[model samples]
Target chain A: MVKSIHIEKLNYVYQSGTPFSRRALTDVSLDIKTGSYTAIIGHTGSGKSTLLQHLNGLLKPTSGSLTVAGNHITSETKNKELNELRHHVGFVFQFPEAQLFEETVLKDIAFAPKNFGKSDEEAEQVAAKMATLVGLPDSVLDSSPFELSGGQMRRVAIAGVLAMEPQILVLDEPTAGLDPKGRLEMMEMFEQLHQEQHLTIILVTHQMNDVANYADHVVVMENGGLIANSTPERVFSDPDWLHKHHLGLPQTTAFAAKLAKQGVPFETLPLTEKQLAEKLAELMPQSGGELHG
Target chain B: MVVPFVYAFNILNLYFFMFRIMVLLILKTKFERERTMDGIIDIKDLCFRYSQENEKLDLSHVDLHVNEGEWLAVIGHNGSGKSTLAKAIDGLIEPESGEIFVDGQKLTEESLWNIRKKIGMVFQNPDNQFVGADVEGDVAFGLENQGIEREEMHIRVKEALQVVNMQDFAKHEPVRLSGGQKQRVAIAGVLALRPKIVIFDESTSMLDPEGRMQIISLIKQMNREEGFTVISITHDIDEASLADRVVVVDDGKIMGDSLPEELFQKGNELIDLGLDVPYPQRLKFELNKRGIQTPSEYMDEGSMVNWLSRSILKN
Candidate 1:
């Protein structure tokens, strides 16, 4: 099977050689399958952000190597080669809307493509398509990005990155600070992009619901190290382990655990509300009578 | 004769002093009565517009009443005028046509100073509100503006930090602290002033899950334990569930005002308004749709779990 990202013994240090030097990632190694949706979860001071920066060659490893989309990135890799790798992996930082600078929304979205060598017409075309994909109306494309609401500006910024058409998309808390509806819309957009475009998506968030809803694979990070790499079901099935790490289970899984504690029988833990409901229905008597009456 | 004259003078002084004390006591109780009767914050026919160029009013003929020590949550989508309401209450912006009575005093330019003292605001971005070099410094900045005595400022700052459970990180710089810690310090700054009302304007939106939880618990404690009225303007449904009252704002109007459970009972309607129902509430709805009968009181996960274990599993 093809791998979207493969890291071997990767280590990263911030402010290396200074008195304040700290190891952000220690011998972290993981493999991301091509076209898979991955969510990285951790508390503050965890190395999730550091590891994400390495996916797109934004941060060079102090040791070990990372291969992203066919480009091998190591401490010794040239800057020119790293830039080439970045084009294949688009990175969206936290509060990406803060990065918007162009006068018009269309211009901002087209900036990256034009910088990557697309013609003005070609870049604008790609930008317009991306804007539509992110659920922005055509009427707002010409308006000043600053004039748009926070959620709209966020979409415009996302469109800017999507216009690059990267095979691998890495987002850091893409839905942070958005309203509930906006949050759902943003996640759904990314899910659609991943499914329809067959893109490899890596999301870094503290929200377990987002993980349970979208992520097929889960990577748990703690204390600058990779702790667990498994499916979301496996990662969240054990409540004690998650709580020990200061992590919370998705509400559905937590509810399932609560039911289990009260002597509800389940062959396997359910990771979603629908699953729990289905399991409960199966345990009910076939008479279809209301139990509470 | 001289002794008799001195006795009369003393008696007159005592009478005047007693009269003054009585008047002061009456005024104080009258003020308290007004505050308790009308609500700590009373808004009537409130209207505001960003500028003449803007076609629609940001807030229009809105009426809201926040009782003392009540936790009121304001929820809405972006551009829904929730933030404008917060700003208006804090005296940061003047409403085009409305009257805001904070602590029984009408909000006006002349009364802004006294009104500001009653309401403390914590904005969305933690970085924007941090004006000091360190946590301790930041907490003390508010007191310094009020010209509090040096020794008294130190006492209040320490007390505030203790309230937010950040007493140990007093010297930490804003840059070094986590998002949660910075927000705690910001809250500490507000607490030092001892404001009667605290407005949280999406303060937890930028934090991670743990951070958000920390701030939420702190807000709850402030309302329940300290008796400070809270007005939290947010988009988070879980946070709104903790409030005593939830007000939904849409298009600069009060769309719905009710208990969180009642509001969420209109599940799809809320979703259509760009709001979300709590997970347990949504799950109950889904189960009902699938022909399963969930207990009506299952508004949270624990209760739902209990019901499922006892009722469905027993059968």
Candidate 2:
């Protein structure tokens, strides 16, 4: 697999060399293996969003280098090539649906590709394909983007990004306020997009359960720096550090903590309740001592 | 025995006179005192639509009386008008045809300022709501706007930051905070206003799961410890499950208003409204179909385990 991103010593100072200057990311470095499902998890103000922005050249790093999917993200890069790079690495922002303002949902999704001078005939077909990818019906083609429900609008907006046929898909808080089912579907879509499309998927989220079940790699950021980078099982295994940063463990971890007090030592800390339940069932007593309760 | 009867008769007559007076007084005071509580955000046949001649607001025969110190969760899908209702209450939008009474003063043009002071709103996008360059400055914005005294403003800013546990970030720039931290500062800004009621308009929607948890936990603390009434607008059914009462709005009207368990019982109706049940609620419902017993209060994680353990033990 090709290495999609190779960022080296990237530094971003908010005010830059002034009295008010604050270093958002200091000497940060990471690389993305093409088609990997990576989650960037962090507390508020961890520069997680800032780092993601750098990935797509949305925000230029103050010093050092960033090469995403293939283009170098620096002012020295030619504008034409940089624009093409943007076409390859899609950035779906939080509340992306709010960016939709076109008359119809179909046109809204087609806007990005059409901006690149794709023929209207070609744009419409791409839009329909993208719409299906995000679970939107063909009927939504004529409905006003603003008139659709929030979840539908969110999906429509995502379809808009997918319509561009980006090789690298980056989403910020894609399922922040979604219901359980919606969250599950959104995460599954991430896996599907990565697996089926061979897309390098970078998801920025605070959901531990998602990080637990889906992400191939998890990166945690705190205090304007990347602190922990590991697999979901390893990251969630030591949730104390997460808690110290004012981050919360998944409910299953907390439940395991409770059982620890009851003399039932959890063999492992499970981030999802299903895992916790199954683990418990496997550890259930065949014949126990006196019931203490 | 004859002497006792004479004293008892006099006392009995005196008690009867007071009882009649008390009955009339209580009846007279019922609605009047209830109106005086700074509670009861009353709306009358409230209506608002983006534009007229295009089938204006479909709301009405509508009535809701939120008591002081109560936490009410409003749940709905996009375009369900939950936000529109919040906007009306916050005076962001005027009801096209109808009236609102906040603490007894109708939301007339002249009374809106006062009503707004009583209700502090936190929007979904914490970034846009931020007006300060730094954390301390941001929290102080609401206080400064209210023209609070300089020294008092400093004290209030500190207190509000402490309330959301963002005191350490006081000197940090608002732009530098994490998605969750920025939200806490935004909430602190509202807290400095000392509003009687705080409306969280899905404020955590822009945050990650971690950020979302911190924000809500702080909000709960504020509501419980600070004695402020809270109205939360949420799409997360799990978050809605934590609320005392859940009001489900659908297609611009109230579809269900009850405790979370009761509302979730209307399974298909809720699904049709574009909402999903919380995890345990869904699990319990599914378990019931399979002859497994699960109670509603077990809807929470810890309690669910305790219930399951005991039930399994009994068998």
Candidate 3:
């Protein structure tokens, strides 16, 4: 499979010169397969954010190299081609509602496309489609962005990025402060986008459940370096390693591990509650009565 | 004639003495009533709106009673008026038609100064609340506002920092601290006020898991060990699960109030309310759906696993 993002010995330094220079990422290398849903998990100050900024050419690598959509970015890479690179990689920051500054939701969604040289009619058409794609009604398109709810504002901000029609979508904690329903809906929408559009989705989050449920690949970061890059099941299978790195397993997996310790017949760790229930039901006697009403 | 005058004077003195004793007894009863109130913070028929002309109230006819030293978690979606309730309690905004009593004193414009002294609030963004350059400076900011003596301020600042486990980071600049550490400093600042009630308005929402855990543990310590009344406004199910009571807010009204275990049992109802059922509860629901009997009381991972192993998996 073609790699959507490739990093080789990537290093990023904050304020790289005088007294306050700090190395944010060091000797980090990873590859995200095309159309894969990748989740980056780590503690704060582990250089996850720094690494994310490198994906869309927002931040130049201090030493190593990054290749995104066949464009190679290095320390000496100029700003000339960054605009082209950004057009293909949409970046959504945390608290994206703060990014919505347009007068109306429609205008906000249309802003990105207009900047990319789309005509007024064309931009509005794309924005209208993006609004529906994000589950917003046509009624809210004309309303001021500030008048909308936090979730609506977030969707508008996201639609703004989606209007650019990027192939690879990068989100940083997209559902951080949303309610449970909103969080679930947002993740499901991203999953849908990934499936239908074949968009490569890279999400940075601390939500282990999301990582377990949505991520095809998991990348664990620790103190300026890539510690593990593998399937979510493999990464979560080693509880001790996760613990040593100050991380935790999804709740169902942790519970399953406890059951296994108590001598329950379990071959694989269950990642979700439904899986756990199915596994338990299989252990019951097939000829007997039901366990509950 | 002189004997009759003396008798009259003595009778007057006796009456005066009786009146004084009655007054003292009434004052004593009033003081006892103040001390014996059921709730430390009592809100009645609270209604508020941003403007009088606005037809809809931001908080509508809400009533709440927070028992002293109890950790009450307020769960709601965005624009659900949970934060509005917090602000009203903190005296940052006054209700349009209602009464609030904090520590047996009615909350009014005249009493706001005193009420504020008993209630401290920690907002969502740590950076926005940090008014000082360093940890100690931020923690002492609240004390300095009350015109406390320098010696007393230093003592309180040290005590507050110790409570949040940020004593060693007193000299660290706010910008240099992690999101968790900055929030700890914010909590320390609130603690320095020595308030009876501390309201956390989505304080852990922006933090990573480790930071969120640290803040939750700190909140638990403040509620349990220190016996501070806690009202945490949040959408985090994990945080709400640890509370003594959970209050669901929706559309500017109180939707439900119950213990965390009981509230989460209505799993689909909670999800419809834009709230999450905790993982253990969800697991129990799934197990029940799969024809495995799991008790509703198994709301935590350890207990759920224990119950499943002993009852269902024992075969």
Prediction 1 global C-alpha lDDT = 0.89
Q: Highest TM-score among the candidates is held by which one?
A: 1
Cα shift from native, residue A291, model 2 (Å) = 17
The DockQ-based order of candidates, best leading, equals 1, 3, 2
Q: Pick the candidate with the highest DockQ.
A: 1
lDDT tens readout by residue for model 1, B1-315: 799999999999999999999999999999988768889899999999999898999999999998988999998888899998998888888889989999889998999999999889988888889999999999999999999999999999999999999999998889988898899999999999999999999999898778899999999999999999999998777788899999988999988889977877676677655567777777777777678776666256566667667775565
In model 2, residue pairs whose N, Cα or C atoms come closer than 3 Å (at least 3 residues apart or on different chains), thus clashing, are A44-B178, A45-B177, A45-B178, A206-B209
Model with the higher DockQ, candidate 1 or 3: 1
Quote the TM-score that chain A achieves in each candidate: 0.96, 0.91, 0.96
State how far residue B171 of model 3 sits from its true place (Å). 1.1
lDDT tens readout by residue for model 3, A1-293: 99988899999999999699999999999998899999999987889989988888879999999999989999999999888899889988988999888888999999999999999999999999999998999999999999888888999999999999999999999997787888998999899899998999999988899999999999999899988999998998888889998898998888888888988877789888788889887875544354453
Q: What are the candidates' individual DockQ scores?
A: 0.54, 0.27, 0.51
DockQ of 1: 0.54
TM-score of chain B of 1: 0.86
lDDT of each: 0.89, 0.78, 0.88
Per-residue CA lDDT of candidate 2, range A77-139, in tens? 555567877888888887788799999988888898999889998998999998988888888
What's the true lDDT of residue B254 in model 2?
Answer: 78
Q: Output the worst ten-in-a-row residue range by lDDT, candidate 2 chain B.
A: B290-299
RMSD of each: 5.2, 5.3, 5.3
